[model samples]
Target: MKLKMYFLLLALGALTLAFQSCDDDDNDGISVPAELQNALAEKHGNAQRIEWETKGTYYVADFYEDNYEKEAWFTKDGVWQMTETDIPGLAALPAVVKSAFESGRYASWHVDDIDKLERKDVETVYVIEVEQGKQEMDLYYSESGIFIKEVADTDGGHNSEGYLPSDLSAAVRTFINENYPDARIVEMDVEKEMTEVDIIHENKAKELLFTPDGTWVSTSWDVRTSDLPGAVTAAVQARYPDYVIDDADYVETKENDYYWVEAERGEEEVHVKVTAEGVIL
Candidate 1:
């Protein structure tokens, strides 16, 4: 009986060690690089409950900051790439961004989720996921409330290697070169009804739309509230004295150009569309 009890105790010790080893390898059976760990610590000082994994060519860290879930991506050399954080609700969004969504084309769609994306050397973007019937889409908006682009939610995200410039039609390329001489195409997306292209011009990001046949639809970019046209600003102030212009978008279409301004007062929000000549639309 004494011999049997000793053997049982030895087995229990081994079992405990096995369990401990598994607890240490909980990060998907992959070892995180020391450099990445240090980089994460430096960037997100308060990050907690971190789990590291290899995502394609980058190291991804899933963790929590200030009780909110976040994911940070880093290059193999430990350079920070991007970070995405879960926004609790629409109320947590910036006033300008929220107002834009409430008045935009997809306003009636059911919002399923929202995230804030921060990338190095780029403007911050808000991503709102909305669904209607069997269709789902992810809309990207700049911090200043300018609509960026929308992509169908397939596989839950967008492809990093979007359409290449070489994939563009000749007419589309000609239009861009003729109109935006200094612009450089950065990304492109082709849909059923229209093709969308993202470009950088004069150090600012802009989105251009074209019909399937390569006819120019519109071009839009963020505009500072203070930089709005005098007539447009005056009209907004005259119409809504209690509201302050927070952000605006200058949209140039084939037929006309207008400013989409977001105005706010306390918790009240409104979107005003005005032509350059101050005609309210």
Candidate 2:
């Protein structure tokens, strides 16, 4: 009986050890859904050392591809949202993208960080984080070197006063001075996908848009509905008779000049672009 009891105690000890070993093999009690695993495999066949975690409504996968760390986010339903890859250095960026940043408006800012964002159905974007003094900003660029947009760092609470005259590039300054010599620049915003300058010329407010390289895109100014061109007024009256002409603007682009008119009837509103000759565009 004594020998039997001893063997029973040893068996119990072995069973407890086995249970502990199995628990250790489980990934912190987190089971990756089979759907998510399948999605990750389909998207990143070369991914290695993958680790998974749940963040908010997204399932995040951290892995390495080509020996570089990468992160991919997927929706709960296994739809790939985006992937971010760390760029080792500026040298790793495409030539056009690198050149654009070197010659762009924020060239003097110190580069803080860089990342490449690849979305499911959108063009890849390169993000460059830069800083000057207390002002930090994120500049986004396309693969072909087109400046996409600028976003100020929210943590710094930087209230942009708009670009000052000194901040304007020579080309931009020359264009404004030659075109609107007597105009005073009221404000300048470098956000969106282009630089916009607000000016007051001859007691009228006008906004000018420019590419990052200082090429002119368009100029626009508000116009009273009654002040709209006869052709524009007639066009709107004929097409949207029940809608009241509430607002209008005269816009001049390199290609052509047109009037943008807004018509509203209750909650239903329509915006129409009509040329000076009354043709709707």
Reference-based lDDT, each prediction: 0.83, 0.79
> Candidate 1, which segments miss by more than 4 Å at Cα?
27-29, 156-205, 208-281
lDDT of 2 by residue, 1-281 (tens): 99999999999999999999886654343458989989999999998878887777778888889877888888888988777888887888999989989997798889877888776534566788899998899886766776655678867642211111225678987999999987655445676779987666665667899999999999998777888888888998999999999988889999889999999999999999999899999
Model 1 Cα lDDT, one tens digit per residue, 22-97 = 9877844467778988999999999988888887777888899998898888889998877888898899999999
The TM-scores of all predictions, comma-separated, are: 0.57, 0.49
Instruction: Score residue 122 of candidate 1 by CA lDDT.
Output: 50
lDDT of 1 at 181: 96
